[model samples]
Target chain A: MDELLRPLVPQVLGVLVRRGADLATAEDAVQDALVEAVRRWPDGFPEDPKGWLVTVAWRKLVDAHRSEASRRTREVRVLHDVAQGPVEQRDDTLQLLFWCCHPALTSASAVALTLRAVGGLTTRQIAEAYLVPEATMAQRISRAKRTVSEHGVGADGDLGAVLRVLYLVFNEGYTGEVDLAAEAIRLTRLLARLSPEPEVGGLLALMLLHHARRPARRDADGMLVPLGRQDRSLWGTSLIAEGVDVLQTALAQDRLGEYQAQAAIAALHCDARSADETDWPQVLEWYDELLRINPSPVVALNRAVAVGEVDGARAGLAALASVPDDVPRRAAVAAWLHERAGEPATAAELYAHAASSAANLAERHHLLREAARLAPDAPGT
Target chain B: MAKFLLLKHYRGGPQQRPNARTPMEEWTPAEIAAHLRFMEDMADDLRRRGEWVGGEALAPEGAFVRYDGEGRPPVTDGPFAETKDLIAGWMMIDVESLERAHETAAYLSSAPGPGGRPLEEWIEVRPFLEYTPPVVD
Candidate 1:
């Protein structure tokens, strides 16, 4: 029942807001309607669930307004106005998304709010996912709602912020009860349906491509398996095909963005039968386009790695020189390039250095193993 | 997000060298000030990034206490004279992942030491046992 109703939350709230309901009150009313649904749906499903929710939530909003002495005058006016307005056939989820990702709220608050309002997640559920106290999550949600209300639902909502929030949720991975990545994909799919923006399609493709590789990303013991070392048999072929299809459609539009560029690179990786068979030149080309679009040091580091595969290690090292020194994984990148260039001693030293600097235990362990493998007289070798 | 405690010890940790060492008291005032400032800046940066939960510096003094017996007066001991390990402080953070916690610890370990060099100290990164149950299936 929850799975069926969750997708309708944003649309229902959007309808109420469009009918002159304040965001906070409208959200509360919708939540009440959801609770009522959970109680009543066991007997039978409604033929028009969306309509039922809207009517019930609207009545709840009006009842609360009428009960308040200060809101009595405004209640009659609002009721009359809502009665006169035509039933909105338009999809308001896009507008609700814009409101949820308002610039006034911090990214954390925005993420929390988006999960609550758009994703239809309870505060306890979000709190559990984030490993924070329920009270803290509740406070964050309320504060975000207040901030959005204060901003007054501006016409020009930043799509970038909405995309960013979704991306953030997707990257948060599946630690909590909810599969945030799946939730993110579901939300983005909805957004893509409502908004015909190519970037939305691009983001969806990127997420699908990355998510397809997730099964092969870690070992049974939860240790990370680097892309080159992952068991190819574990990769999701169907997801890869879907992602490629999505990326191709988005690319056909010719309005390229960062996500599309990234998805292109991922698709190239997916196309390869083995690490050695990877189309390094094509991957490097996508990275170049990504740099032109985003120009981040992280992208530059990745480009340097791709350069090592396309050109020689020496060329890759030269490219790495342009990336800032303080960037993470510099030593690991240097080690990989040096090993490929047949400089074993330097590569071993760099691997050790990278191990010390590595933040993730799995990565650190991997680097340490690499260093030990390259040692002059490794034990048991 | 997961919570982690970045523990700083006054002495006796995994990386504490038995012979080659200089205590903070032996450092020059400028070096000490630089190290302190670096720590402060790290906390500030964590706060700005919305990762910081709380942090505090512990005094060098402490005590051990135990119950003498049921319904009896408690027994107390003064701070140990030759304690090998002493907790200096701790910074609690709520970060996106264990990787991020490790990154923050590494950054904090880079605090300046004698001669304006990185201390390269060993910081213990301990995960908080969450009270909330896992939401995942």
Candidate 2:
């Protein structure tokens, strides 16, 4: 099914772009057409599946226009142009991508909308991905659609906004039910074809490298295991090699975006034979480049860890203190850095607090384990 | 047609628990308005289908039946307790089928509030059953 739908994306998107429609609407119409074809085409497949989808979706939009009184006249005016166009020549997906990730929408909403329309995800899938209820996701998408209709002027302006939206989606840690990491990679690969930016390639490489080790990141019961504790035998060497290969090519492009820098960090980590051999200095340098570009406190907090590994635990503790209190993972990082700096009592106290404050059970357990290891005589034991 | 009572449990007078902290507000003003709009739309849809009995949004959490101790008759109160987890309001509806009731629930939950967030709190839907018993031999 994936193979069959793969080739139809460009053709379906081409027609949608030409229809002068929003990506959300175009995607809805296309999905409606796809459902119809799935129901009817069991005897034999159509030779030109893309052509059929374009025709069906075009008709569906007309029907939709006729049903809604406000859009009737506007749609009627465009009917002639839609009829005259050859669907194959148009690049609908690319246009839809830009429209869905329009700068007017918030970054979160843009990623949500793009995942729905371009990534072919249902509201349930998106809601699961974000740990929101399905109803909430549905409402979010509906409000976004209304906003686009009432406020947005259409997708004639910026593509960088769209690229940033995709990258953000990639960075969000997996939760709920959907694997956003995989979905983001797929969208980046698709977007790379439309606009082959080095950052796009870099984002893809970064995702691939991280995802390659996903197997070893957690235990059978879903507890997080740090890189030093992870079983290296479980890592997918092929994915690591592929990610390295992609990052190398992207680095050669000389664009040097934040994503490329992040990918470079991942590549260096993947290159090390063991945890001790991992180049903390190189990772710290790349993180500095990332900070120069993005200037995020989260990035600063991460860089502090590298600095600690390279410079010493006391320096890392000071760096961690410089980060804001509310930033995610602040306490855990602080606890670990404090532990390394010969302050076991302070480390255990912070670790216990961090464990209690953890959002998920796995993280709580991991934090508690570190706390217990640091203080054998602690009461919780 | 079947009728549904979206029952909100409002205890009359102030809450007895002194240590209860102030309830965290669920939705802001914008969220409440959006939810009202959704309820209005749902009622309108039901009315159009000839299945809507009549629904009313109650006054804030203060209005409810007050129970008297020692088997005395219950009285009503205007401004209610300081309970944080109080039900703000409810809606009663008359529908033709269980499916329609579910549809109404779905539509009501789809209303948007702050930052495009949905006002998705739990809503209970129960059937109004009518049973006919057989005569004894």
Candidate 3:
């Protein structure tokens, strides 16, 4: 079998699925075919691997039908459907993408399972990557699969949902052993290939733009360094270039969505040679669009930062005031706004509180850095 | 070196508030055995790496005692109602520092167990605050 076929297994599974053959059975049969290839292909290579696997999996299903009575009932008339030569390649992979990211699964499980089953990552590798025990990850994947299967969430038009899942996974700063950021990009590329949707392309661009600066997100002590303080020399220029190119194309399409709005925001950040040079007005405009679509408190909080940059700190604080007080990152955003407004005393107090109450290590470190920068003579130190 | 208590909490510690339970099907015996072996191997590997410390797993049932007026120790029934939140077991270790202690604990928590899942058992870790030795006058 061609080695490339391995990467395209998710695409193959997408193609095999019909209206009657349930997704679970299709996935199992695909795995069986892959296993058979692994066993037999040790000697040499095949001319057409995708066709080979499809043919083999179809046969395996027949053999399976003889013994498994329950599965036989669900099995539809799939004969010439197994032929894989010169087939009209519909964007079937997009359906698999959406199915894996169905809303029924938790955000974490959706990303993990998509990477595993769709991305063809081994369970152990996935577990190790995520800093989870293999058993725990296995159970998570299984549970996610069962949820999708039992809920009968068909592999239909769920591109938007999958895009959200990918974005959520990317935003979870890497605390676990996993290189979640890189994994997110890889999944995004696959999604982009299948769907070619503006939002999917936009997400890939946004992730790339953010990731290009990951080298500057931290310092020697593993403490988080904010975008303003980061050394621009360390940023991945090549990634930024690629991201800009993709985002420009997506923008040309003019099909605005949350990911596209986010990409536009990222594009503004990437365009700035220095943090002070950022186009805050443009970013604020994008955030307005994002808020209109997503309507999230977190988005509103982020929007305030851009407002502060564009319309002065007082204006930003007023914008933030409209947000519900119970928002998770409200204090952190308020602290930054206060600092921008030249109220160091209030900023320091808010930073101290936010640092102590931060949900994750990276954010806590970021808050502490901000606090320390403002109040070096504080008594606690 | 550092010491860790597999420290079952007595009280006043955070517990995971219940959330929706994900339904799972029963695993086959082979799956169960694979999970158990993974855990045993993990513990052995930790010990081989010189990370394992003295450990114990207490029975679910336990006894409690109270002293009153320093006259005599009052014996209480096993599992007194007041002792409902007592320590279940403890592990003691002398690690180089807190980071190493965390690494070891994370390892233990990741070990596979019954139900083909990593154990969800919660263990509290506390560092012993040094106390002044008694002086002889």
Task: Tell the DockQ for candidate 3.
Answer: 0.03
Residues B1-137, model 2: lDDT tens digits: 34565533233323423211222254567756765676677666554443444455555545568778878988886553575445545655545456767777656545554444553434556554322110000
Worst 10 residues of 1 chain A by lDDT: A78-87
Each candidate's DockQ: 0.06, 0.03, 0.03
What tens-digit string does per-residue lDDT give for candidate 2 at A31-94?
6786777677776788878887888887777677667655568666686466666665655677
The sequence of per-residue lDDT tens digits that candidate 1 reaches over residues A83-180 is 55545777888888999999887778889989989999888888777866676677678777987888777788899999999998887677768888
Could you give candidate 3's per-residue lDDT for residues A164-221 as a string of tens digits? 8877667654554556677778878877776767988889998998988888877888
Candidate achieving higher lDDT, 1 or 2? 1
The list of candidate 2 runs beyond 4 A from truth reads A6-10, A21-24, A69-81, A131-135, A151-157, A172-177, A359-361, A378-381, B1-137
Better of 1 and 2 by TM-score: 1
The reply for model 3, stretches above 4 Å from the true place, is A1-6, A18-21, A32-43, A55-91, A153-155, A173-178, A376-381, B1-8, B12-137
Candidates sorted by DockQ, best first: 1, 3, 2
Which candidate tops TM-score?
1
